[model samples]
Target: MEINKFIDHTILKATATEADIIELCKEAREYEFFSVCVNSGYVPLAKKQLSNSKVKVCAVVGFPLGAMSTEAKVFEAEQALKDGAEEIDMVINIGELKSKNLKKVEDEIAAIKNVIGDKVLKVIIETCYLTPQEIVIASELAVNAKADYVKTSTGFGTDGAKMENIKLMKKAVNGSAKIKASGGIKNLDTALSYIEAGVERIGTSSGVSIVKELKG
Candidate 1:
C-alpha cells in the first residue's frame, strides 16, 4: 500500500535539538517518507535539509496546546510558510470549543486557512480532550472552515487516536476533508489499522520503525 507515503515523519518534542531535526530530515530523505513534521521555528532548517528531495516540510502551529490566540496561530502559520513549510498542522482551541464557542473555533481555523491558501491545512482537534460528540463537532468545524484534514490528537495529550474516534471523524467529515490519525501510533499493526479505517495520513515519530516493519 506504499505505507511510507502515508507517514509524516515527526519530531515535535520541546527538547528536540538541531541535530535531531537534521537526523530527522536525513532519515526522511533516506526512507523517502511523505514529509517531516516539525515546529514552526525549525521550518527553515527542515526546508534547507530537505531541499532537492521530494519529502515536504510540515510545521505545527498552536502545537500540543491550542490555547494561543488566533492571531498568534495565524502569524505562526504565515511565518512557517514564509520559512518554507509546505503544510501546516494547527491545533484548535479546545477551551473555546468546550465553552460552546463554535463560531470562534470555526473562525480560528478559517482565519488560518485564509492565510495559508492552497498550502495544506490540517486541523488538530486534540481528540483526547473531547467527548465523542465533541469530536464530531470539531471534525465538522474543520470541514466548515475548509481545512484539508481533520487530525485526531497532539500526542502530548492524555490519550491519542482510537478506532472509535476515527469512525466518528470519518462520519463527521463526510469526505469533505481527509483524516490524519496521530499520537500513540507506534507500530505497523496500529498504523495499518488506521489506514484500513480510511485515514489518509499517519503522523508519528515511529515512521522509521513502521516503514522498516513494512519493508521487512
Candidate 2:
C-alpha cells in the first residue's frame, strides 16, 4: 500500500540537535515519507531541507502534555505555522476531560482549529490516559469540534498506539475523523496492522526502519 506515504517521520527528543533534524529530513527525503513531524522550532529548518519536495511539515502543539491553556496552545500553533509548519498534531487536555470539564476541552480544540483553518489538525487523545468510554467521547468531541484527525499517543507517555485502541477509535469516529496512530510503532508488522485497523496516518521515529522491514 505504499507505506512511506502513510508514515510521518518523527523526531521529538528534547536533546535532539539541529544536525539530528537535518538528518531526519534527509532520511525523509530519501524515503519519501508523507511528512516529517518535529517540534515547532525545527519546522523552518525542515522546511528548508524539504523545499520542492512533496513531503509536508507537521509540528506538535501542547505536545506531550495537553495541560496548557487554550491561549497557549493557539499561540504555539500560530508560531509553528509561521515557522513553516503545514500540519499540526495537538494533544487534548486529558485532565479537563477526566474532570467532566468537556466544554473546556472542546472549546480549546475548536479554538485552535478555528485559527488554523484548513491546515490539518490531528487531535491527540493520548489513548493510554483515557478509558474506552473516554476514547469514544474524545473522538466524538474531536469530530464535533471539527478536528481533521483524532490521533493515538504522544510517544512520551506510558504506551504508544495499540491496535485495539485504533480499532476502538475507528469505530468511535465512525469515519468522521481520520486516525493517526503514533508512538511505539517500531516495525512493519505493527505499522501495517495499524493501517489495517483503520489508521490513515502514522507518527513514529522508526519510519525508515519500518520501511526497511516492509522491503524485507
For TM-score, the strongest prediction is: 1
Model 1 agreement with the true structure over 159-184: per-residue lDDT tens digits = 99999999999999999999999999
Candidate 2 per-residue lDDT, tens place, 1-216, comes to 799999999999999999999999999999999999998889999999999999999999998899988899999999999988999999999999999898889999999999899999999999999999999899989998999999999999999998888888889889989999998989898888888877899999999999988888
Give the Cα lDDT of each candidate.
Answer: 0.97, 0.93
Q: In candidate 1, which residue ranges exceed 4 Å CA deviation?
A: none
Quality of model 1 by C-alpha lDDT: 0.97
Q: What's the TM-score of every candidate structure?
A: 0.99, 0.98
Q: Which candidate achieves the best lDDT against the true structure?
A: 1
Give the clash count for each candidate. 0, 0
